[model samples]
Target: MGVFTYENEVASVIPLTKFFKAFIIDADNLYPKIVPNQPQTEIVEGDGGPGTIKKITFNHGGQVKIIMHRLDIVDEASLTYKYTVLEGDLISDTIDQIVKEIKVTAGPDGGSILKNTSIYHIKGDNQLDKEKLKTDEEKGLTLFKIAAGYLLTNPDEYN
Candidate 1:
């Protein structure tokens, strides 16, 4: 198998605690509320902590797609979250798995900085589409903005 890693950083005006709470701690609850055509998420195994498995069902394009994720780490004090895509339509014949790590820290100007690393494990010597990966990265950033906007509108949330 071959592996590829992609790293991205996004700065948010929201505070570290609030951002972390909304984005990482309460993501399963918050995502469906903030995103359009809300995705359905359920805990399939284990507690909400490490080793838990989550199933997410969402509509992509005109088709329904499901994704399963296994939580590797969920640290609240350090504001770090990690998960690996275990199965579903997101995984193609060329891809075996995708592991994602996210860390939120206090940024300058009283905001927060979110750093994300995606490690893709490919099957055999297959290669991934760079453009598709870039688009996925942009979508991830858009999710951050969506959460920030939701928090901005609802001041009492994730406080």
Candidate 2:
């Protein structure tokens, strides 16, 4: 088996508390609402807390796929959230699962620093491409930034 990990840090001008509240706490409800022409998405189950098995569906070119994620931890005091992708088209035959953890902290200029760590577990003797994974992660980050931007402009939207 092979294990690969990637970590990234993003600094934003938004306050830490606001960023966490919008991106972490209210993401499920806020994401699809803010994005324009976004694919049909829904949280098929759970209360958006720990142990919640939430399934998000994505449709592209008439092909629909569902990704199941189980929330592992949600630490409000520490501003940390962790989840694992249980099933998805993103998971390859050689890949077992993906665990993602996000933490928000105060930045030097009173903004926020978002820290993300992703661990990919692979099947035996399988070598996965890291560049593709990085691209996917970057896409997610962009979407997150879009959500953050919406929250910044419409302060009362997610609150």
Candidate 3:
């Protein structure tokens, strides 16, 4: 299998702890509430820590799409989280799996820096679809913005 990795960083005015808590710790509960179009997440197995598996279902273009991801790492002390998408509608025949890592750090001016890395494992010699990758990245950023907006409006929610 072939692999491709992409990295990006986003700066947010929200504090590191608050952002991490809202975006990583409470995402399953917060996303659907804050963003009406967000996916519904349910823990399928294990606790919320490492090795946990979550099933996420969402509506896309009048169709339902479900994705299952397993938690690889969840470190509250360092504000780091990693998960791998093992199965889902999002995984095409050319893709074996997708691993995502996120780290939140204290940025200047009491803000936070979100660093993201996505590793795509291909099934064969097919080239990675740049359009799909960009669309996924945009969707991720949109979710981040929605969570940040919610946290900003309700400062005491994640604190």
Q: Residue 108 lDDT in model 3?
A: 90
What TM-score number comes out for model 2?
A: 0.88
Deviation from native of the Cα of residue 93 in model 3, angstroms: 1.0
Cα deviation in Å at residue 17, candidate 2?
1.1
Write down the TM-score of every candidate.
0.94, 0.88, 0.93
**Candidate 3 regions off by >4 Å?**
60-64
| C-alpha-based local distance difference test score of model 2 | 0.81
Q: Which candidate number would show the highest lDDT if scored against the true structure? A: 1
- The better-scoring model by lDDT among 1 and 3 is 1
Better of 2 and 3 by TM-score: 3
**Predicted candidate 1 versus true structure: per-residue lDDT over 58-122, tens digit per residue:** 85453337889999998889999999999997689998999999999899898999999999999
> Which regions of candidate 2 fall more than 4 Å away from where they truly are?
38-47, 60-64
The per-prediction CA RMSD against the true structure, in angstroms, equals 1.4, 2.3, 1.6
Per-model lDDT: 0.89, 0.81, 0.87
Q: Please, what are the lDDT tens digits per residue for candidate 2 over residues 1-159?
A: 789999998888888888888888877677676765454545667776688888777654432267788899999899999999988876779889999999999998888999999999998899878897798788778876887688778877644
Better of 2 and 3 by lDDT: 3
Task: Name the runs in model 1 displaced over 4 angstroms.
Answer: 60-64
